[model samples]
Target: MSRTIKHEEKYQQFTIELDGDEAELAYACPSEDVVDFTHTYVPKSERGNGMAESLIEEGLKYAREHNLKVKATCPAVAKYINAHPEYKDLLAHP
Candidate 1:
């Protein structure tokens, strides 16, 4: 099943929804050239289940599809990119 990414403005957070519950939350700082993902975390119950990686992976797919560059400031996002070399092209200044 496909998950959805939802932005909750009141909470100032982005959530990756898996079947309705939040799998992960992502916070980003946007800029003219790139979007810096400042924080990304999954609930303790969801950890070790690849939920966070799923969100980051889909987020990267969205960025590349929209021609956006990524500046992953969030340690989770940064590590995701490093491990997934295929996403390197979407990195800012890459």
Candidate 2:
């Protein structure tokens, strides 16, 4: 299925619309330069299709473009960044 990830600034989430269903990765900015990824949700029908990964990748790209550090509060996002070492530099430091 074709999918497009979009940043909803008012909601602070990256979302994908598929077949009229929505999957989103939510985040919060706790500081000027840091964005904390708080949650990810994909409907059961949309699961196992890598939609969440696409949302995370879009979020990461947003962070990079904005020059913001990322804090992966969501377990899946943390794991994704761990597996994709190239994204490690985007991690926020305490």
Give the alpha-carbon lDDT of every model. Answer: 0.73, 0.94
Over 9-90, each residue of candidate 1 has an lDDT whose tens digit, in order, gives: 4664567765445665455646655666777777676688777887787777767877879888788999999998999988
Stretches off by above 4 angstroms in model 2 are: none
Scored against the true structure, residue 93 in model 1 reaches a CA lDDT of: 71
Best by lDDT: 2
Q: What is candidate 2's TM-score against the reference?
A: 0.94
TM-score of each model, in listed order: 0.74, 0.94
Maximum-TM-score candidate: 2
- Residue 8, candidate 1: alpha-carbon lDDT: 66
Candidate 2, run of 10 with poorest lDDT: 13-22
